[model samples]
Target: MKSDIRVCASWREHHDRPVYTLTATCPACGGDAVNSAPAPYDPTDRYGEYRRALKRRARQ
Candidate 1:
């Protein structure tokens, strides 16, 4: 079995200050690391679909 992993935003604080964090995941493998760097070929991500859906709802 395979599970989809994705990089979602996280948050941390510097001495209680606001901050943002970046993380990665693999959708095909459970808890596996994902590479986000430019690939030799085209890079595809599911985030685009989410963005499009949001846009559609916003326009409604």
Candidate 2:
């Protein structure tokens, strides 16, 4: 399931550490917020290239 938790995009101006929140906007600075969760896929996945190629072929 997707996470509802997010972090302020402009956290540097508001606090020394990352600020976590459940809302789309930050409560402190009213700035934009982004998902705090790590990416689900591995960066070095060996099969990723093949998967992408298959997707492109299907599209064409």
Candidate 3:
């Protein structure tokens, strides 16, 4: 059976620091099938990328 993998965000607090982990799972199964060793992307910079895109557009 082929299972479609879906990316999910897991948020929590560790040692007073916010931890964001990107996890992958298959609906056909149950919980996450893969837990990334390090986050694929930074949660804090979520809007930063968008802001940078806007700045680039303005400069064009």
Candidate 4:
């Protein structure tokens, strides 16, 4: 299951530090919250092209 943790999207404007919460809105500022985790894949992955090619081949 996805984690319940989230961070305020406008944390910089609302607080001196990031505001983490389990809800969809920041407790302090009532602003929208976003998942705090890093993306599952790296954008600079060297083998990403090869992986995409493999998936494309499998699709056909």
Count the clashes in each prediction: 4, 0, 0, 0
Model 3, CA-based lDDT: 0.46
- TM-score-better candidate, 3 vs 4: 4
lDDT of 3 by residue, 1-60 (tens): 323433333222112333323435434333344443444555688698888899999999
Per-residue lDDT tens digits for candidate 2, residues 1-60, read 578999999898887889899999998889999999887887899999999999999999
Structure candidate 2, residue pairs in collision: none
Q: Considering every candidate listed, which one attains the maximal lDDT?
A: 4
- lDDT pick, better of 3 and 4: 4
Worst ten-residue run, lDDT, model 3? 6-15
For all candidates in order, the CA lDDT equals: 0.41, 0.91, 0.46, 0.93
- Cα lDDT of model 1 by residue, 1-60, tens digit: 223332322212112332222334333232334333444432487577888899999999
TM-score per candidate: 0.28, 0.62, 0.27, 0.64
Highest TM-score scorer: 4
Give me the overall lDDT of model 2.
Answer: 0.91
Where model 2 places Cα greater than 4 Å from the true spot, the runs are 42-44, 47-60
CA error at residue 10 for candidate 4, angstroms: 0.3
Compose the digit string of candidate 4's lDDT tens values, residues 1-60. Answer: 466799999998879999999999999999999999887777999999999999999999
